[model samples]
Target: MAARLRRRLALVALVRVFKPGTPGVGRRLAAVPRLIAATLRGQYDGAARLATMAVAAIYLVSPFDFIGVAIFLIVGVLGDAALVTWLAGALMDETERFLEWERGSGRRPVA
Candidate 1:
């Protein structure tokens, strides 16, 4: 009941965060570097997400994969694509959260 409602709300929020043509695409893209910098500088707010993103990145490059290359090449490629898609969504969600935190904490840029 309560947990299900929370899950539903979270799904809705995730969709809202990553919807295509959402404004600030450039700003969001720019935030990737900033996010990395912040994470490296010891900001732990998004450390878990950053760690997952890093692992996804490493999996993309690593020769060994859960879906082995020797197995169907198409399946391996599809697995990689799925991982990339998840990575992109995760990045967007984390960046949106970071932006919200920045605004609420008086770190918003002067306009």
Candidate 2:
């Protein structure tokens, strides 16, 4: 799973961030606000998932500061690791989905 996640995130960054054309990382970054708006407007069925991911993100970092890292060094590091792993995978996947939706969206692409 670790190797798979590593490959997935690396390839995504290579193709989406470095490669030109299409939305890529920049396009996905731009789409973030739109994605949120769409989710709020009842456009995306995965809105609950998005909220859960966000909450998990917040939960991961919040209490870790004062309780996890300060008292338990190993636990702090583990929390950090989980944060990196989860956020990296989530960002890569969500952006890809948003890009696909953009391509299939109602607005036709300009030649």
Highest lDDT: give the candidate number: 1
Q: Can you give the TM-score per candidate against the true fold?
A: 0.70, 0.66
Task: For candidate 2, list the clashing residue pairs, or say none.
Answer: none
Q: Write the per-residue lDDT of candidate 1 for residues 1-111, one digit (tens) a residue.
A: 111111123234446664675536567777777667766877526677688779989988887875585587888878887777777666666777666555565665433
Q: For each candidate, what is the lDDT?
A: 0.64, 0.61
In model 2, how many backbone clashes occur?
0
Q: Model 2, 1-111: lDDT tens per residue?
A: 111112245235434555455446665666777777777887655476578668877867686565877788898878777666666556656765655665566643232
Model 2 TM-score (2 dp): 0.66
